[model samples]
Target: MSEKPINDLSPVVIALALLIIGAEAVFQLANAGLVGGPRGVGWRMEGIGMFGYSPAVLERVLVQHDFSPDILWRFVTYPFINVEIVQAAFCAALTLALGKFTSEYFGGLKVLAIYFMTAIVGAVIYGLLVEGNAPLLGGFTPVYGLIGAYTYVLWLRLGQAGENQLRAFQLIGFLLALQLLFGLIFGGGQSWIAELSGFAAGLALAIPLAPGGWALLLHRLRERS
Candidate 1:
């Protein structure tokens, strides 16, 4: 991605990045005993427990066919819980970087729309596909949604330029490869399903969310027909 000034980021994207960073900042402060007192150190874990998306909780709700506002809320809130500062920083950077690019194409409001929508879709897919106690926490899934938007833009631009549209997938492919490598070495769970699901949802969303996206898609469909 090109170097766009942070100021160029949309207000909504900025707020989203701030929320992710601010959450971690509070946790770090608590860890250092600068805020929330001695018991504050547990704030991170507590927040994760309350906000993290747990398949177990989801399974319970599914079996009982019960719906709770708190359980549903985790779909949106899980992204805010970060286990480590470095992980949060990486998520924030990608959010800002990709959010700026996607906002240029879809506007600030739609950028946020894509973010939350993908987060929800990702969580639902995670719950359906992965069975375990480990919860899904962190904004990377939603951030991957932004990358999907970015890929859509590139795909459109490449087609307009008479280039191979397949090239637009390189970014996602590389990122997934890197993620798989890390997972192999560290031995992780099935969170990649969430990330990939988010990406797919983001792409699907662009059909309606992107400016003129519906009409353009229709035009392409007609061309194929």
Candidate 2:
């Protein structure tokens, strides 16, 4: 098999990974008391309030029919901040790996589109579905979108090779199974709503993002109809 050049890794992927890791590092420094101000320890709560997505805030905006810039931007910003180091590290690792694969196969622009669109859609779903004051934070939702994109790529490859197309779904199945086990062991959170939404968004977007994807999708739809 031919090996791809190391330089083939998308700059967009590297940049996104750096941004997530960098933000997490700042948050960690703040949480460790090594950094002063909002980014330091003892202040992460405030930071979360400011950056994390709050359904209450979104609800207020909807109820009042007023959208403030700060609240409006939360949809895009929430994915950059995480609650813990381990969470951030896990998300960053996924962003780098899945982002690279998606970017290589679909191009950097599509990868970025899928990521941000998934994040927005996930946030919207969470806002509408989840109640209460628990705010949604972390990068996993968008990372799940990347996972969806990767799965789509795998699905395409499997189809072309006459392999079991369902096998491409194994990654998501495993993740969801782990999530189920974790939830059973230690109560479930609403964040899964957003994460799963992200994955669905990524998978749907793949139909349009893949090469000749739109045409293929339309043809299939026409045939089905």
Candidate 3:
């Protein structure tokens, strides 16, 4: 097989990486007083208030019937912002690494769909299940969605190769293990709900988003029936 060129990065992958890193860069600069002003220190916090999905705000919107366009936009915008550079770097790394393969396999549109849809679903789950005013921020949730898409592709490839498909889950297993360890050391937060939900959403979406995935799902269902 011919070697793929390094410069042949998918546009969707590049776009995702840029969106995440660029947002973080702006936040970092503002925080450092390189841009904006003393008021810049609060810029990211302000963005979180405006763009991050707050379960409290969601509650007010859904439970109390208080409607606002800001709440609606949060579903799509939350994934672009992060708390700090470390958080953003981790997300950007995952997005570029997994998103390249996912976009190549599922196409740019489906990859974009999975990312945004997973974010929206994740936020919805957080709104319904999680309690507190801690707003959901960061790109990790959507990155986990990409991980889910990658896992699905690996699972399919493994099954076709007559290998144990269970091995495909090792990535998530390792990540979860690390998360548990981190939580134990640093004290856990509720954001895992959104991240896990994003993963589940991505996995379920892969059933329809993957090429021939819908037909394969129907075939399996018919066989079972």
In terms of TM-score, the best-performing candidate is 1
lDDT of 3 by residue, 104-131 (tens): 8898889999999999889889888987
The sequence of per-residue lDDT tens digits that candidate 2 reaches over residues 53-122 is 8787678678987688878888888888888889888888888889888898899988989989999889
Candidate 2 local Cα displacement, residue 130, angstroms: 1.0
Candidate 1 per-residue lDDT over residues 101-206, each given as its tens digit: 9998899999999999999999989988886777899999999998888888888778767688899999999999999899999987788999999999998897
C-alpha RMSD by candidate, in order: 2.7, 2.9, 2.3
List, in order, the clash count of every candidate structure: 0, 2, 0
* Superposed model 3: Cα runs more than 4 Å off: 1-7, 218-225
Query: What is the TM-score of each predicted model, taking all chains together?
Result: 0.93, 0.89, 0.92
Alpha-carbon lDDT of model 2 = 0.85
Better of 2 and 3 by TM-score: 3
Q: How good is model 3 by TM-score?
A: 0.92
Whole-model Cα lDDT of every candidate shown, in order? 0.88, 0.85, 0.86
At residue 52, candidate 1 shows an lDDT of 86
